[model samples]
Target: MPLPLAPLIPLAVRLGLVATTTFALTRLVRSATHPGRTDQRAEDALDDLGEGLSLHRPADRAEDRQTNATARVRRVVRFRGKTWELDAGLMARVRLNERKE
Candidate 1:
């Protein structure tokens, strides 16, 4: 007797195959670029953000206090080019005068 195809294959196996193909394509494109052509823009952006903010990993009884303090400090600001706030999400952008519109 032949086995059922859909029931025999697990969902994880299908997802893994898709992921493997994507990784292969990404590597191919990355390798196609010359070594010196590699851009440090992304790295530089990350370093700049790290300089502006610090992450606190709490492990003690004071974690809750620290978290609350940070949360309360959040505020909205309006300025020359645009209006926005420096919060968890904007922290990633870390740009000045940037607005959604």
Candidate 2:
């Protein structure tokens, strides 16, 4: 006996439909997991660098010997999103983004 083509047509249609849906879903998942769309890792790297530098002291005994060492040591950092601006003067408006957990 020969297999019926009419019965196989519905089965093939269902299988094709399922395969297309699965392919689309997998593509969406891959796009979602892409690095560009996920958490901002560069911001974390910058924060780590800043923290590491904060733990070290630069070789500037001349400035340390001065009476205005505190004034010279003061720093103003303005970080918006991924952009960062550093100012070493007074009377400034520097806003920083809150660190993530």
Candidate 3:
């Protein structure tokens, strides 16, 4: 007697559809929650340019140094009005060194 296989085809298709749907939804939620880095980089660049062009007294060297140091030490991402530190330590050091010219 041949084994019956017709009954499992629909069940397998439904299971595959559910899995694909769940994976897509998870990716959509993840992307919605995390803003892209390009936007953040453009904002930072604009802020720096504005600071450089301002008529007011420039920020003191000490303050600038402190800001640069802290920025290198703690990379953060802003999402949903919340700040999250994303990288530090060795990777931060590597990024800091890349600026040397």
Candidate 4:
């Protein structure tokens, strides 16, 4: 005997819609609460390094660092409402040297 799938189709569609709505709402809330490109960038870099490095920046200086880079290969980031200035080239160089040792 074949089972009935017609009734399950509507249920499945409703569940999918709910899941998508929840996901979208969560993202919207997160973005609104924390609004800064620098903060996001810094967090991503730290995650990539996996060096247990933490971010600390002064609230007053956050705006300035967010728009400026220390060097050609440098980037500014904000972490926990603080500004972090990172020099990617220098970091890479140091990492390379460590590997060569």
Candidate 5:
């Protein structure tokens, strides 16, 4: 008897289509270049975003980093239940943080 080939054939075709499409799109994006190229627009847009976007000013960046470092060194994790304060998580994190520092 012949092997069951009907379902396998369509699956193979779909896999081939997907592979070819992925290859084409990968080439499209990876081969990006300057003006007059296929992916010039995409490349230029990404370049513009990288050049234009800034989350913080240079003067404040140091201060922000210092604050974050200090907090990371000092913070304690805790879950508050019916009690006024939960000390189990807090004391453990504090001990660990203190040891690390």
Candidate 6:
């Protein structure tokens, strides 16, 4: 069957736009789900960690330790457009995405 050229041109343009939009959307989702670990802190925090007891640096001062002890142990972090409350284990994972502790 022969199709009209004018209608076909508009249809092809619309399809191209739709394909481009879908491709962009997919890239966004993929990047969020599989975020690259580009920060040094995050890499260091996750480095050479195995079935051994983890070590934490001593507090800078007695006051800092006292304040930290009274503060809440849990922290809230945002990842991939979602909010996550991190305990001990999850905090390590989130720290990998930052440049500082």
Top candidate when judged by lDDT against the true structure = 4
Local accuracy of candidate 6 as per-residue lDDT tens digits, 1-101: 97769868988999999999999999999988965568778555544334334435346543343221111135689999999976442222111222455
TM-score for each of the candidates: 0.27, 0.32, 0.32, 0.32, 0.32, 0.30
- What's the lDDT for candidate 6? 0.55
Model 2 earns a TM-score of: 0.32
Model 1: per-residue Cα lDDT over 1-101, one tens digit each: 97778875788798999999999999999999876764588455433443233445345535243331111134578999899885431222121233567
lDDT tens digits, residues 1-101, model 5?
Answer: 98888879989999999999999998888789545646777455433442222343344445344221111122345556433432221111111122334
lDDT of each: 0.54, 0.50, 0.54, 0.57, 0.47, 0.55
lDDT of 4 at 52: 31
How much is 10 displaced in model 6, in angstroms?
A: 1.0
lDDT of 3 by residue, 1-101 (tens): 99999999999999999999999999999988966556676455544442111223235533333223213243578999998975332211112122536
- The pairs that clash in candidate 4 are 38-78
Candidate 2: residue 46 lDDT (0-100) = 36
1-101: candidate 2 lDDT, tens digit per residue: 98768968988999999999999999999988956654467444434342111222335533343222111123455666555555332211223345669
How should the candidates be ordered by lDDT, best one leading? 4, 6, 1, 3, 2, 5
How big is the positional error of residue 68 in model 3, measured in Å on the Cα after superposition? 33
User: Candidate 5: which pairs clash?
Assistant: none
- How many clashes (backbone atoms < 3 Å, residues ≥3 apart in a chain or on different chains) does model 3 have? 0
lDDT of 2: 0.50
Off by over 4 Å in 1: 1-8, 35-101
lDDT of 4 by residue, 1-101 (tens): 99989989999999999999999999999988966466677555545553333344445555444222222245789999999987552122111112334
